[model samples]
Structure formats: C-alpha cells, structure tokens
Target: MHILFLHSNYPAQFGEIAANLVAQHGDRCTFVNERVSGDQQGVKCVTYRPASGATKQTHFCAATFENQIWRSHAAAESVAQLFRSNGALAHDRPDLIVAHSGFVSALFLKEVLPEVPVVGYFEYFYHRYNSDFDFRSDLPPQSELSAMRLQARNAMLLLDLHHCEAGYCPTDFQREQIPAEYQPKLQTIFDGINTDFWKRDASLSESHATQRMVAGVTIQPYEKVVTYVSRGFESMRGSDQFLKVADQVCKKRSDVRVIVVGEDRIAYGGDARFTDGKTFRQWVIDNNDLDLSRIHFVGRVSREELIRVFSVSDAHLYWTVPFVLSWSMLNAMSCSCPVIASNTAPVQEMVRNGQNGLLVDFFDIERWVECVLQTLESPPETQRMGSNARQTIEQNYCLTSCLDKMRSLYQNVRMR
Candidate 1:
C-alpha cells in the first residue's frame, strides 16, 4: 500500500507511528509537510515553504483584516501547488492520506486533490461562549463569538472533510466536540508514547545526556522536584489552579520545588502582550505571592531535560479539564514519576485513583494539594504506584501498540 502522510508540521502526532509504518513497509510511505523540524529515516519528505504574510498593524484594525485574509488564501494556494508538482506516485496512488491539519493546510490539500481521501486529526473545536471566553484569559476578548470561531475554526485545519475522506482525534472528548454530523466522520485513536525511551529506567546520570537541557532547565537527580509540563501556564492548562494548590502545598513542604516545562508566551503568540502582559505563569506567581526560590518557572524546557526531571522528581503534577492527556503526563508516568491529575474524563482514563496514580477533582483545590503531598510523603507507595504506571504504559499505551492500532485503522479505512 502506498501511504501519503500529511501534517502541517511533519511527525507531530505521527512520530512513533510514522517510524513503525516505514520500518514495516519500507518505500510504501511518503510524507509531505511545510514544517519538517528534523528528518525521518524511511519516509520520503518534500519540503515546502510555509506561506504566511501580514502587514504590521499596531492593533488588529480593519487595515490588517484584508492582509490576513489575503495571506490565509495565498497560503492555501501555495500548498495546493506544491502537492501537484513535487509528490510523484505510481498506479498505487495513496491507499491512505493522513494529515494532522488544523491551520488551513488541509483545506489547501482538498483544493488540489479533491478525489484523494484526506484524514485529519481534530485537535480542538472551540465553543467560544461562556467559559470558553474566560477559558482563554490570555487572549484578548473576541468581538463576536460566532464570527471569531468561524475564523478560528478555519485555523483548526479540519475543514478538509468537505472534500477529503475522514478525520481522527486523539481523544473521544475531542471528537465529540465536532458537530454531531461531523462526528460520524471522526475516529478516535490515541497517539501513544514510546515506553522504552520514557521508562523509569532512564539513567539518572547526566553523562548519558547529549548536553541538552529542557527549555534550559538542568536536571540534577537528587533534588526533591515536583514538575508541571505544559505549553504554558494558561487557563485551559489549569495554570491558575496549579498555582493555588502549589502555594498551599509549599506551605508545608519547603524542600520540594516546582518546575514547569514549555513556553511562557513568546512561543505561543511570539509576544507576551497577547497573553495579558505577564503571561499566566507571571500573573500567577505575582498575584499568589509565590516564592520564586521554591517555584522555578522554567519556560519551554527540552524533552531531554524533562525526562531528567521526571527521572529524579518526587512526583509528576498535571491537571486539565476535559481535554486529552498531555504527552508530558504519559512521559512522566512512564518514567515512574507518580502522577497526580484532575479527575476529568481524559485523566480518569489514565489515572485509576490510588492505583497507578492519584486523581483529584478539577475544581477542588484542596484535594489537589493533598494528593501531591500524600504521594511524596509515602515513599514506598509512591514508588509502587509509579511502577504500576510504567507497567500500564508498557502494556497498553506504548508506541508499538499504538502503531498496530493505527495500521489496522488505515487498512479498515481504505477497505471501506
């Protein structure tokens, strides 16, 4: 079978699956992307320029509106042109065309190859009303929810279905968010983790490391670190709640340190001003009166450094409401860092309270603090629970298992 993998950023969700597929069926898989960060071994990758242009506007005035509209349209056209010219195939065509599109890229692909079956990974569908608006305090208030969502949904890049084959989501919660009519076109498959790499057995010694640090945070094995990894300390990520609980947790344990991974604001919108001046991390620390000495706001730590932190930390802390589980949480769990997460749908799927790890209510700030404290206080139980987490990941959520499921799904989709 000839497979064409499409993602705006190559190997984003397909990292493990892509490798496994290419290894199993060499020369049968080809990938095309605008943003290929690093090369992948077997998959033929064609590089294309990312088409994005906009005039500088002091504010998002009407003058900037036309420029952005033109840019988005031009980006779609550029992608279409690349697909037709560079990507060559035989009578086999593509048995499956998989894309992780959400930024108008997929729309562009449809414009070019309307007959090809394009599958999208639906990451998010926003209902920009009620909590949704406040859910993103970092973002300036949108003038109109429906109008803005129509624009933002275009950013989802999932609109290819009108001309493409199907769609996929990493979580059921995510899939359900799509319009009920669209849900029929969606399939839920988790992008699993590689247990071998993420396992608790990663050497605590820094000599094995390639001298890389996560977001520049060094990993010293002996420190009593409690880590939180996210794109940022934003509302959706429960950053405010984490701060509240952290402040309370620190009141009792002075030795424990909190380290959060991922970008602050510069990585998100390129400017912190978009995220309300201080960013969520800064806002939390300032308003909560957190001691920076105990709380280290490590922005955009590298994956290697993150592993190092997990290798040595007392516990891994992740809290989210109704969203898919963060890849960092799985890595933390695979590393045998006992996870303490909110008892939301996605988290409940991973953490089986007092089994592999612990779960707390999303809004219950006190329980969040208690679980973290209790996990650290009980060393033996903590280690045992951590072991359980690793074992669970190895058996079910491992990369190999996920690949098997992915291949089967592709075959099934093609056969249909």
Candidate 2:
C-alpha cells in the first residue's frame, strides 16, 4: 500500500504513524511537507513552497484563507510533479492521503487524485465564543473584525470535513466542537505517549540525579519539586494563575522549588492584556511578589530533559481553560508524576479526581494552591496517585493502542 502524509510542518502529529508505517512497509510510505529539514529513516520526503506570498494589501479577514489556498496549490503542484512520468523523478500515486485538515492540502489532493481516500487530522474548530479565544476572563475584549476573522478561518476546515473520507481528533471533547453531521465520520484517537521512555526511573536518586539539572537548578531529594510546562507562558494555559499560585506557594513554603518550562511568548489568544510592553513572564514577575531564586524558568528543554524533570517531580501543575488539551499533561501522567490539573473538558477526559490525579477549578488559585500543598505534604498518597496516573496512560493512551486505531481507520477508509 502506498500512503502519502501531508502537514505544513513536517511530521506534525503524524510523525509516529508515518515512521511506523515506513518501518513496517519499507518504501511504500512517502511524506510531502512544506519543510525539507532532513531525511527520515525509511520514508521519502518531498518538500513544497507556496507559489504566491501574502501581500500587505491582502485583506486581514481573507488573508488566512488565501494563504491556506496558496499552501494547497503548492502542495498539489508538488504532488503532481511526482506523478509526471516524463519528469526526472516519477513516483506512483498514493493509495491514501493523510493530512492536517485546516491547511486544505488534502482537499486539493482530492482534486488531483479524485479516487484516493484522504484522512484529515481535525485538530480544532474555531468559534466566536466558547472556544480558545473567550475561555479566559483576562483577555481583552474582542472586536467585530476579530470575530469575523475567526469565523472566516474555518472556511477550509468545513470544506476539508466535507471532502475527506474520515477525520480523527485527539480527544472526543475536541470532536464535539465540529458540526454534528460530520461527527460520524470523525473518530477519537489520542496522539499517544511513549510510556517506555516516559516512565519513572527508580534508579534516579538525589545523589546521582544531580548530574543533570533543569536550568542549572540542582534539585535535592529533600526539597519538593513542583513543575509546570507549556508551549508558551500564555493565558490559555493559565500561566498567570500558575505564577500567582507559585508566588503564594513560595511565600508559604521554604522547601519547595518551582520549575517552569516554556518561552515568554504567547502561543495562543491575544497578548498579555495588563502590561503595555512586557511578555507574559515579564508581566508575571513585575506584578507579583515571587521569589526569583525559588522559581526557575527554563525556556524549553529536549524530550529527554523533560522526561527527567517529570521523573523527579513530586507534583506537576497543569492549568488550562476549557480549550484544546496539551500533550505536556499526558506526558507528565505517563511519567507517573502526581498531576494537579485544571478541571476542563480535555483534562477531565483523562484525569479522574482522587483516582489518577487531582483536578481544580481554573480560576480558583486557592484550590490550586491547596491541591499542590496536599500533594507535597502527603508522600505516600502522591506516589500512589503517580502510580495510578502511569497506569491510566498505559491502559488507554499508549502508543501501541493509538497506532492500532489509526491503522483500523486507514483500512476502513481504503475498503470504502
């Protein structure tokens, strides 16, 4: 079987699946992406670039959709070039195309290879309210133009959903955001975690673990380490609340250390609404009375370093509004860290209160502080919860199970 994978960023969420298929089936798998960073182990990668650039004159509302169309056109042209038998390099057509939905690459592929089945990765469906933008109370008020742009961004998403044979969302909470009629064609499959690599290391001890430290802060086994990770220090992930509670915790406890892993930039939503010219991290520092020495803001670390932090942490703090889930939370769970997460749809889907981990209200800084204190105070209970958290990931969100589901989806679409 010949499978083609499409993503604007090379191997976005489809990396594991694409690599697995290539390993199992050898040269039958190919990846077409907008990036040509390097080579993969057993897959052929073809790169594409937008034929036209977004001009300054492009209307703000239509700019996003126009850029998506440019990506679709460029990817379609690259795929067409591969099929030209007269070209220097000719490749056979794919049996199936798997792509990220919002880019509209798969939609254009349908026009080129009309008979082939395309599986779209439906990550999220934007909305004017009740979505990422309005989930937080701290965000600045939205304008009519901003709301219109948000609606306009979904133009390609709706079209992709209509044309694709099947779509997969990482969580059912996300799948519910799509139109009800399209829900049947969508399946829930998590972007699974590698439990073997992320598991707790029993051999790691205070004496030996000092060799590798997070941002040069050596964590002693006697001190309780609390960790918070996100793609960025932004409002959607509740970075503000986390920092406020971190300040509170630091003032109350002497033996606790806070390690935050993320950049100061905003990954989602508007910028820091309170500050005139400050990053979110800078704003948090300027407004709050936090102990600079107790908190370590390690911008971002490698995968191995993250696993190390998760392994040694006594408690992991994951706060977010009712938005898309972060893989950082799941990865922490997989590493058996006692997680204190916000009670949102995505977090609630994976974490059960008093079972695997503890959940708290997103806005309640007191409850968040209490939960972290509880985890730090109770050693046996924290270890038990960590054990349960690892078990949860192993049972439901492991790599093997998710890949099996993906393969089944592929077969179902191919047979149809």
Candidate 3:
C-alpha cells in the first residue's frame, strides 16, 4: 500500500510512524511536508511552501481563517504538481493520506483524489470557556475579539472533520474537546515514546560518584534534584506555579536543587506583560522568595541529554492547561522519574494520583511543594512510584505498542 503523511512541520507526530512504515514497507511510503529540520532515511520527503501570512487587507476576525485557506490551497497545488499532469495522476498516487488537522493540508486532498482516504491527527479543539483560554488564572482578561478569533481558528478543523475518513487524538482528554457529533469519528492514540532510548540507566548513579555539573550548576548525587521541562516558560505550561513551588521547596530543604529546561519566552496563552519590565522567568525569580543559587535554568538540550537528566531526577514537574499533553512528561516517566503533575484532564488520564505519580491542583502552590518534598524525602516510595511510572509507559505509551495500533487503524480505514 502507498501511504502519504502530511504535517506543515514535517516529522512531528507523524515522524515515528512514517519512518517505521518506510523501514518496513520500503518505497511504498512517502511524506509530504512544508519543511523538515532533518532528513529521514527510507522515506521520500516532499516539501511544499504555503502562501504568505495575513496582511492589512485581511479582516481581523477572518485573518486566521484566511491563512488556513492559503495553506490548504498551497498544499493541494503542491501535491498535485508532484503527481499530476493535465489534471491526471502523472505518478503513482497515494493509496492513503494521513495528515495533521490544524493546517488544512488535507482539506483539498479529497477534492484532488476522490478515492484515497485521509486520516487526520486531531490534536486540540479550541473553546472559549472550559479550555486553554480559561484554564489559567494568570492570563490576561479575555475579550470579545479574542473569543471571536478563537472560534474562527476552528474553521479549518471543522472542515477536515467533515471531509476526512477518520481522525485520532493523542489523549482522551483532547478528544473530548471536539464536538459531540464528531466524537464518534475520533479515537485516542498517543504519539508514543521510544522506550529503549528513554528507559532508566542503571549505570547513571554509579557513573557519577562525585559532584556533577549540569547547565553550569554543581549537583551531587546525594542532593535532591527536582526537574521541570517545557518548550517555553509560559503561563500555559504552569511555569509560574513551578517557580513558586521551587521557592517553597528551597526554603524547607537546603539540599534540594531545581533544574528547569526550556527557553525564556512565551509559547502559549499569548504575551503576558509584567509591571517590573522583566520576562516571565525574570518576573518569577524577582517576585518569589526563591534561592537563586539553587535554581538552574538550562535552555533546550538534546534528546539524549534530556533522557539522562530524567534518569537522575528525583521528581519531575509537569503542569499544563487542559490542552494537548506534552511528550516530555511521558519521556520522563519512561526513564523511571517520579512525576508530580497538575490534576488536569490530559494528565489525569496518564497519572493516577498516588499511583504512578502524584497530581496536585494546578493553582495549589502549597500542595505542589508538599508533593515534591514528600517525593524527595522518602526514597523508597519515590523508587516505587518511579518504577510504576516506567511500567505505565511500557505497557500503554511505548513506541512499539502505539505503532501497532496505528497500523491496525490505518488498515481499518483503508478497508472501509
């Protein structure tokens, strides 16, 4: 079977699955993307550039919608140019097309190839009230204009839902955001982690006998190491809360050190301006009573380094609004790191409070600090939770199991 994968930024959610299919099926699989950071072996990469973004002529509310329209047209035209001549298939057309739903790349694919089925990756559906917009208290006040824009953002996704053969989301909580009428068509299948690469390293503790320096800070194996990671230090990921909790932990325990991994910028929930003329990171540091000496902000590191960090961490902190789940949290769990996560929808699905990991209310700073300190104080309990965390990933969210389920889903879609 000829399978075609699509994502504006190539090799994202589809990277592992596409690469696996190419290795197993050889030249039978191809990937169509807008751009790729690195090349993938055993797969054909086709690049397509969408038209420029919105301009002054575009209506304010419709600007977001118009950008998607451009993407839809550009992707459709690019795919056609590659495989068509005189409005006919000039090369072997795809038997099945799997695409990310946010970009509208597959919006026109059905119009181009009426027979081939398209399976969409449904990551998130926006809502004004019980969603990311309202999940956090630190965010700026919402307005009617912002609400309208948020509503318009879903124009493309709604279109894809109606046109695509089937759809899948990474978590059940994310799948719930979609309209009830469309829920039957969407299934939950996490973009799994590579267990072999992320598994706990038995030699990590023994190899580093003396004090070790990570991100320019010295940390002895005997010291309590609490770690937090996100793509950016933003409100959506609960960076603010993490900093506060770190302050509390530092005051109680002098041996504890907090390692933060992420850039100091806003990636989600829009820009939040501080009265002190400091970035969110700086604002947190200045306002909180944290010991600057114990906090280490390490910008983005490589995947290998990330796994190693997770392996050595005493407790991993992960918090986010009720949105798409972070893959880093799963990787931390796969590395047998005890996780203290927010009691949100996406996290609750994976972390059973007091089971694999402890969950605290997102805004409950005292409880968050207590959980982290408890995990640090009790080595035996922490070890048990860490073991259970790894088991959770191995059984459900590992690459091997997720890929098998993906292949079966694709076959079912194709058969229909």
Candidate 4:
C-alpha cells in the first residue's frame, strides 16, 4: 500500500510507526513534515517543508497564531498543486492517510484529497484545561492564565478530529480524554522502546563501572540512585516536587542520590535563564548548602546514553501532573530499571505498585519520598521489581509487538 503519513515533526511517534510498516510490508510511505529531522529504520519518506517559518508563541496576536497552524494547510496545498502540476496524485491516490492530529497537516490533507482514508495520531484532547495552574491554593489567589492558554490550544484540534477516519492514541489515558462521540474511531497502540538496544544484562557492579564519574569516582553502587528523565525540569513533570522530595530524602538518608536527566528549559516552567522564577534546576543549584550534593543533574544525552542511565539506576523517578509519561520510562522498563511514577492514568496502568514498580501520590511530597526511600532500603525487593519491569515490557510493549500492532491496524484501516 502507498501510505501517506502526516506529522509536524517527521520520525516522531508517527515516524516510528511509519518506518515499522515499510520495513515489514514493503509499503511505500510518504511523510509530509514541518521540519526535516532525520532518516529512520527503513522507509521511503517524502517531506513537504512549508514556505512559512516555524510556529512562534509571540505576545497574543491573532494573525501570528493563524499563520502557524495554517502553514501546514498551505504546504499541503502546495503538495496538491505539485501533484496537479505533474498529474501525480490524480494517477494514483494514496491507499490510506495517517495523520497526527496535534498538527495542521491532517485537515489540509483532507482538503487536498477528499477520497483518502485519514487516520490520525490523537496525542491529546484538552477541553478541561491545565488544573495544575490552579493546583496551588496556598500561593495567594490563582490566575486563569495557564488554563486560558490550554483552552486556546484546545481550539487547534477541532478541525483535525472532525476530518479523521480513525484516531490512534499511544496510551489508554490519552484515549480516554477524547469525547465519547469520537471514541468510536479511537484505537490504542502501545508506544514502545527498542528492547534490543535497551535490554542489558550486566551485573550491578559492572553496570556501575560505566556510570558518569563526577570528580572521578564510580557513583557507588551503595548509593541508591533514583533517576528522572525528561526534556526538562518543569511544572507539569513535577520536577520541582522531585527535587523537593530529594531534599527531604537527602536529610533522612545518606545513601540516596537524586539524578535528573534531560534538559531543564520548558521543563520547570521554562528555563531559568529566561523565565524569572527559580525553576527546579536553579532551586537545586541554589540549595547546594544542604546535603544537596547528592542531588545531581545529568545534562541531556542521546538514546544510547539514556539506556545506560536507565541500566545503572536503582529506580526510575517520575513526577507528572497532566503531562504524558516520557518514553524514557518505557526505556527504563526495557532495561529492567524499576520505576516510581505518579499515580496518573497511563502511569497507573504501567506501574502495578509494588509489582513491576511503585506509584506514589502525585502531590504528596512525603509519600513520594517514602517510596523512593523504600526502594533504597529494600535492595532485594527493588531488584525483583526491576526484573518484573523488564518482563512486562517484553510481554506487551516490546518493539516487535508495537510494529505488529501498527501493521495490523494499517491493514484493518485500509481494508475498510
């Protein structure tokens, strides 16, 4: 089948799925993207770079926002114009259209080729808004600014949802957010990790040997490293809470270390340099007078580096409010890295709490600290949980299984 895939960023969640299909079925896949990032496992990818510039979140200006969302439509129109200019699409329309709803491409693709079956990657649907904005009742009266920002963002999905033939959500939690009326077309697919690259069998001592040596000493295996991975240290991620609890944990125990991996900008409510507030990163840096030396931040690293981080850690630290859990958690599981995630929908499903990994109260700093401390106190139990974590991924979320689901779903959608 000649499949046309649309995503704002090529080879993201949709890119992996698209690449998987081409490798397994020899399907010719054309990917229209906002930016050209990189090549993939195995796929024929054709990119459509919009003549317009990248989307910017400037001071509230109606004209600027419209230009950003509609850029993809303008670009897809160019795709149709290019086809008409060459009589290409007219000769052979795509068998199916896979789109990502968070982007503008799906709506424009619908306009360009009225007959193509359009399936979308339904990343999110935010009708209720970011409650985290109001979550802090203690810090004076609340402002609706964040909620307003989220509501304004919700308007972007309306066109994409109405035009889709089907929607694929990476997690059941994400799927649940869509309205019941739209749920008929929703399908759940596990966003997975490449187990081959992630799965490592080195002993604890061996794994500890390669860990980042700060001031030239193997981060001792005796130290219980609770690691958190993400794109930043931000509010939604509860990075601040993680760090705050790390402070609490540090005072209570000497053998514990808090390691944060991933960039901190746009993480702890934007980077410290630009954003006025002391983001969790800056907070950690400021509070180094305490046992804060144990609180460590590992700068952003590549995928292979992340696997190594996951492999050596005793626990995968996670603190999310409404944000989606990072792929790092799945990679951690593949590496048999036990996770201590917030009890949110997707996380609740992933972690069986004391089974594969532990789940803590999202906002309860004391409880979160206790859970982290528990893992350190009980090394044997933690190791057993880590083993089970890997087993769970092997059974349900391995790369091969995800590919199988993708190809099967594509066939089913195409057959219709």
**Residue 270 accuracy (lDDT) in model 3:** 63
Q: Against the true structure, what is each candidate's TM-score?
A: 0.81, 0.94, 0.94, 0.87
- Which of the two, 1 or 4, has more lDDT? 4
Give the range where candidate 2 is weakest over 10 consecutive residues by summed lDDT: 203-212
Error of 3 at 159 (Å): 0.2
TM-score of 1: 0.81
Backbone clash pairs for candidate 4 read 233-267, 233-268, 234-267, 234-268
Residue-level lDDT of model 2, residues 145-255, one tens digit each, is: 878889988889999999888989999989999999999999999988878788876655234435446556787656778899999988888898898888888878888
lDDT of 3 by residue, 1-416 (tens): 77888887767888777887778645366777878633577667777777687899987778977777788788788777867866655248888899898765598877777788999889889999988887765656667787888998888889888988898999998898999999999888989888988887766644557786665567885788899999988778999888888878988998888888888877777646442456677776676666767888889998877876786689999999898888999999999999999999899999988989999999999899889989999989999999999999999999888888888888899899
lDDT of 2 at 339: 94
Clashes of 3: 0
Q: Please identify model 2 stretches exceeding 4 Å from their true place.
A: 25-27, 86-91, 205-212, 272-274
Per-residue lDDT of candidate 4, residues 1-416 (tens digit)? 87877776767876776776678778777776767633556554556555664345554423334654666765577558645665574546678888776645567666778777877777777654444444433333334554455566655565667777777888888887877888888889876677888885475425554444531224774676778888877666776677777788888988777777877566533234333576656765575444568776777887766666666677778877654567778888889887888887677878898899998888888898788888878878988999999999999888889878876777788888
TM-score of 4: 0.87
Per-residue lDDT of candidate 1, residues 96-170 (tens digit): 677765543455555565566666777766554433334344445545533454445443443455545677787
lDDT of 1 at 59: 32
lDDT of 1: 0.66
Q: In terms of TM-score, which candidate is stronger, 2 or 4?
A: 2
